[model samples]
Target: MRAPVAMKKVVISLFAILAGTSFALAADTGCDAFKWPVEREQALFPSAPAAQSGAALTVGEAVDFSLAAVDTISFEVPPGHAPAAGTFGATARVTVPPEGELQFSLSDDAWIDVVQDGKTVKSAAFSGVKNCPGIRKSLRFKLAGGAAIIQLSGAKKADLKVAVLTPE
Candidate 1:
């Protein structure tokens, strides 16, 4: 009788622990917590094809870029923040339409600067969350629409996945 009761208690404790773990996992993947829906970006991240650094980027395409040391790439405009030693960076070009609000999503934490006509385009808004599975940060820029350079710097990793999206 005593052995059976002890066994039952152990089973109940194990179930409770499993339940809590499941809940935590669910919360970590709650990517919808962003200000706007990120379903398109989220879906593209997993299978997006890789593109060379400095390649021309298309709107709504997620591309993985291989980064070099910060000192190696020649940025169209100086990076908004000076990259510290050991940081990685890269650059790419894109064309924006007039009166457009573009959202740039990144797979890892990094500093993003949009330069058009020799000036840095100011970001209209930004959002970031750690619990989101793939994307780590996003920035929305209001641009006059022309050729622009996307300067990515101060990243901790050597490779980054990025998507330039026109929000839905």
Candidate 2:
């Protein structure tokens, strides 16, 4: 009798765990798929300063710009992925603070690269939501303290917005 009761309790516990996990997954679909909070990035997308390509950018401030044709934009270093014709791209200079990890947020779909020392700094982590209103993607990269080039390529649209932030 004791053994049967213990087995029943284990089965009930497992069932409850699975049911809770399913509910959590169902709740986080679609626009809520991001693993971390992006409220700061979302709030900064609007009213951010408008900046042109090749201009200086700063952390904690968002900048909006119009992307030029991919073939016309000169990148400090070639983008990892070669963009096809009809795609838009741009480059901007930024001095990353000594902070550990920097988050790059974009308002649209695009390939982002942070080049330091003339080489591409690999992204540590990234997240994106398709059809999500306003913001589209966010990426984190560990960059050495100093000047770095921000390369944006393969954007489907000409109008683009970007922001570099220190993750809180």
Candidate 3:
């Protein structure tokens, strides 16, 4: 009887070990699966300018648009740090085609400023919209053909999508 009890204990311990190992392997495999998609995006949009960190913006074939991570952006907090803590930012160089309008949109939780020729054309802060549902703000500006800089800032790390549209 003592021998049988010892054998049973050993079997249970082996089963627990196997189960834990399997779970760990599955978790690692799942993380690896997500890496490929990010790698593919980086390969396809090789020409896009690199952000301070994270992935580079992907320029759409038909339209000039970029989806970028906010955490990678390097933001400069005001001297007084008026905004709440945890603010970050990034800038992107965009080309505005003739007769095209630059449409900048971001999650309601973020703040954005579009500047051209050292002039701030549009700026907004939506921090008060916490209770609002799906509250995304977009600003459209008539852009002349040439280079433009977009400055983005936010209190939280999130993704920002920017697009430039031309008349069909």
Misplaced by over 4 Å in model 3 are 1-83, 123-135
- Using TM-score as the measure, the top candidate is 2
Cα lDDT of model 2 by residue, 50-155, tens digit = 7778979888888898889999999988899888889999999888887747899889989999999989999999999886688889899988888899999999
* lDDT values, one for every candidate: 0.87, 0.87, 0.45
Please write out the lDDT profile of model 3 over residues 1-168, one tens digit for every residue.
266988999999999999999998776542233311222222323243324422323223211223345455553332122334555555666677765465443333455555567666543221122322322344456666677666666535444333333322
Give candidate 2's total backbone clashes. Answer: 0
What TM-score, computed on C-alpha atoms, does each candidate reach?
0.81, 0.82, 0.44
- lDDT string for model 1 (1-168, tens) is 256988999999999999999988776555766777778888998988877768888998989888889899899888889988899988999999776779999998889999988999889988887878888888899987788899999999998999999967
Instruction: In candidate 3, list every pair of residues with a backbone clash.
Output: none
Better of 1 and 2 by TM-score: 2
Q: Predict model 3's lDDT versus the native.
A: 0.45
- lDDT of model 2 at position 158: 93
Ranking by TM-score: 2, 1, 3
| Model 1 ranges off by over 4 Å | 1-29
- RMSD score of candidate 1 (Å): 4.7
